[model samples]
Target chain A: MIAKELKRGIITENSIFVLALGLCPTLAVSTSVKNGLGMGLATTFVLICSNIIISIVKNWIPGKVRIPCYIVIIATFVSILHLLIKVYTPTLDSQLGIFIPLIAVNCIILGRAEAFAAKNNPATSLVDGAVMGLGFTAALLILSTIREFLGGNKIFDLMVIPGFQPMAVFILAPGGFFVIACVMGLINYFRGKKGAKAKV
Target chain B: MTDTIKLILALTLISLIAGFAIGKANYRTKDRIAAKQQAARQGAIDAVFPEGFKIKEMNDDGGILPQKYWIAFSDDKLSGYAFEMAGSGYAGDIRFMVGVGLDGKILGLTVLEHHETPGLGSRVNEVASTKYIWFPFGGDDKTKPWFTEQFEGISTLRPIGVEKSAGEWHRLSEQARAGLRDRNAVSAITGSTITTAAFTRAIERSVSKYLEELGGYCCPATRKKREAEAGAAAGENGEETEGGDDS
Candidate 1:
């Protein structure tokens, strides 16, 4: 059951690439691989922590005010994460800047809390959160790799090609959209080809 | 209803716990955070005045930005002045420290914080492998460290200009270097014109306030002449007239 959830979240239903949730931070911080990884892990931690807490208290939460309760729970984890990052990792703290606080509103955590955690047991909800968080992190990694390699002519600040002229646009806002579009397009194109072969 | 009451109670309880947790975290990190901030400030000061100097905070002087001003002494003699200044940059506010020799020439400058675009204006504080500011046409050699180093030895007599008219990153000629020393021209960063201009304006404004505060100081002939030039410039600028009026 846990394995199925992991596969489902990571591949069958990716939050960013497939379901297309939480695209704002996806575009904003994917300018570099380091930022993408930082944001991805931060969001992941919030997701896992919120899901566990929400599942434990799911029975106690009133149905009419469940949404508010979930938000409060998610926000608590986000605030904790924010303070931890600010104190222990100030470099990543300043780099992510506004996005750190904005994690409270990231749809992935709330989406899972309402969709899966509300009805699942604590153990199941924990697995679901971990898998979903990994999915988000993987998607961000792919997008950031493409953007950073082309835009910065480096991967994790290491220059790949000595004299490659980096396309500056790839690291900016518009470039994020372009990279996301192309990656999703390529995925769909292969999927369509696979579907055609099945028909044959 | 009883259900509504329970809901409110639950929400309040969660809020209380969250607040307490955050408060605890804040308490634990407060001292470390302050120490880190002080270390960063010390690093900026060290970078600006690589030549040894002792700096002390001056309480009575209020500059244009209401920031703390520090007096630097080298070898038991007044060496320069260091103060904080902030201005609107291309993306957001740019805060930096300026180190000026007693003769009004810039000893060094260090950017404290800025939110400019990366790979462009954000390169203001980028450190280079070496200290020398290379001449133009140095390929990608003219980087962040080079830009700030250009201000060194340039006095604050005149407003600096971006290299817009020249359209070339040529080396400063002997005459041009003299102009730089005389505070006539300080070349701006080639690609980051707006950020460069903002920085220049911040320096000019802060230097003006610094000169005003130093007006009563008994200094040498050169310091007196520089003071007169700064005083005249200060008189014309009415926007920041508070410094002069109060004194």
Candidate 2:
């Protein structure tokens, strides 16, 4: 059952692909696979930690001000994470830059906190956060891989196609939308085929 | 009424706890963060000069606000000076470090912080050359970035200006590559002339200001004379002092 729920987040309710929760950071950082992966892992860390804490203190939080309470908790965790990253992993800190602070306002985190963590047990909420975060990361990775590979003729900064002329447009802002649409179209096509076969 | 009071108390308690936790984390990581920042600045300074150069921060005797610079030493002698260069760019301030050699030539330049558009203005930070499989259609062929690399070996004594028109380099024939290596020319980023011009102007201003203020100390002969004068003054009454050491 828990396994099924986890799969649902990764597939059926994938934040970027299926639900389209956080698109701003998705588009901005998806210029490179490395940046996408870094952002994904950072968001995942914050999500799991915040989900567990919120679950533990769900009852203590007042209903009238729960939203503000979540913000405070998320902001606190983000600050701690930011400080830790800056101190221990200065390279990643500089690469991620402002996005680390932006993670606090990411809706996927607060959405999950309100919908799942607040209502569920600590263990369930933890799993949900992890699964949702992994799903988000996976989407970003897919999008960035395509964008970086085609746009820069490189994968994770490695020269893949030795003599390919990189299409500079693909790594730009509009390229993000084009790639996402194409990927989404492919995913939907496969799903539609499966649905037709099931009907038969 | 009772519920309202309870809610207020709960919110206050949560905020207090959250604040305390963040405070603790900040206190724990404050020193490490500061150290890392210092290391980053040192790394930038190191990149501005060639190998085997030590950077010593100079005191703000002239009281230049927000612009702190350092002097470089190699082989137990002064080599060049690096300054924290900044300018109002397209979006926000573009900050960089520039190494001006003893002969008034730029040794190197490195962008430290910037808030330009990601794909366009942000190209200022790009170090690697864009490669093409076939003919190099792009005029920029050097492994180093054309924007800053052009400044290398170019004397700051001349006025620097960005290539304002397109195909300016393409129009120049192979024979003119050397003779047309304008001492006062910098290649601007395509589609981001504002940012390119901003950085070029900043470099020009900084170099001229440095020349006017400390031109005497930059040359070997003048530096030796200044040192001898300081030594003689010290022997007489210990009154003369150069810029104080920052590091």
Summed backbone clashes in each candidate are 0, 1
**Which pairs of residues clash in candidate 2, taking residues 3 or more apart in a chain or in different chains?**
A163-B133
Off by over 4 Å in 1: A1-4, B61-67, B89-92, B115-155, B162-198, B216-247
Best by TM-score: 2
Q: Per-residue CA lDDT of candidate 2, range A1-200, in tens?
A: 87897788789889898888888888878877778898899899989999999999999888898999999999999999999998888756545667778899999999999999999989988999999999999999999889978876766755566667778678777888999999999988998999999999
TM-score of chain B of 1: 0.66
The residue-by-residue lDDT of candidate 2 on B1-247, one tens digit each, is: 9999988998888899999999999999999888887787787788889989988876443322123568888987888888777777877777777888888888998777666655456667555544443445543555445566656776767777666553224234555434335546766665578888776777666576565556655443453465576674312221212111111
lDDT of 1: 0.73
Report how far residue B80 has shifted in candidate 1, in Å.
Answer: 2.1
Candidate 1: tens digits of C-alpha lDDT, residues A139-187:
9999998998897566665556655777868877788899999998887
- Give one digit per residue, the lDDT tens place, for model 1 in B86-146: 7787777777877887788788888776766544465565443221122223334433465
